[model samples]
Target: MLCGGTSAARPATDETQQIADKVKPQIEEKEGKTFDVFNAVEFKTQVVAGTNYFIKVHVGNDEYVHLRVFQSLPHENKPLSLHSYQSSKTKHDQLTFF
Candidate 1:
């Protein structure tokens, strides 16, 4: 990937799921509802001062959501935050920058 450019989308790994899990509560609070199935299905990353994760999540059944999560640099010791999200999605939807 080019410097500061987002990487190509990748299939979600256990580590990716952990990253998604870290920001799940923030997402739930923002949406004012809880998800029964918050599973990371795919992801892309962009390196900034720290890193940005663009993830596709399976909320439950045919429902899905895309999340933009930010993780601060290790030394900063900040918690991951839900930078943005798109709800009411489906499994067929492509995971893109949003």
Candidate 2:
């Protein structure tokens, strides 16, 4: 058998766009609820296959949050990852990531 380890590649932008297209209805159709980038409280994302990334926005003063939303298993409740946290003196508003 010969070795052929080259894997196929797809554009990341396209994948992200596809996911957004699927979830647009939920974002816009929430009953009387508007997503203000400055006041983002929480977010939800779904993944059928491959990577689906939605951003976590915050509409606060310090702009302490600039994170991307993750696709989690519907049953599992996972906390936000704080791996890239910085040692700043500003207090950041708390927001839940789903």
Candidate 3:
């Protein structure tokens, strides 16, 4: 018989931070803006044999950005992947903002 239990949550590891650091510059360049603040909202590991990280960033007044970073398993030796775009519009629409 096998039993499974949830693991305790852990703070962001150095590797995760490094992934964020590596992706931030690209996001800033593509968005043509500087981020005043950035927060990681989600992290998943061993999902689909890789890791995923989601980040929310504030670029300026009423401007918000979301980024997703995917890192393949080390055994695969694949390069990191990233996707980023403005998320505030959707948030506003959902909130019924005019």
TM-score against native, each model: 0.93, 0.27, 0.53
1-98: candidate 1 lDDT, tens digit per residue = 99988899999999999999988889899999998889999999999999999999999889999999999999999988889999998888887776
Count the clashes in each prediction: 0, 2, 0
Tell me the spans in candidate 2 whose CA falls farther than 4 Å from its real position.
1-12, 31-52, 56-98
Instruction: Name the better of 2 and 3 by TM-score.
Output: 3
Which portions of model 3 show Cα errors greater than 4 Å? 1-17, 41-46, 60-62, 89-98
**Residue-level lDDT for 42 in candidate 1:** 94
Candidate 3 TM-score to native = 0.53
State the lDDT of candidate 2 residue by residue for 1-98, as single tens digits: 11222122222354444443444335435423443433323332334332223333333455433234345455666533222211111334332222
Indicate the residue-level lDDT of 66 in model 2. 27
Put down candidate 3 lDDT per residue, 1-98, tens digits, no spaces: 11222123334466656776678788778767667655443233334457555544344566655556777889999877775444663223221111
Instruction: Write the number of the candidate with greater lDDT, choosing between 1 and 2.
Output: 1
Report, for every candidate in turn, its global Cα lDDT versus the true structure: 0.91, 0.34, 0.53
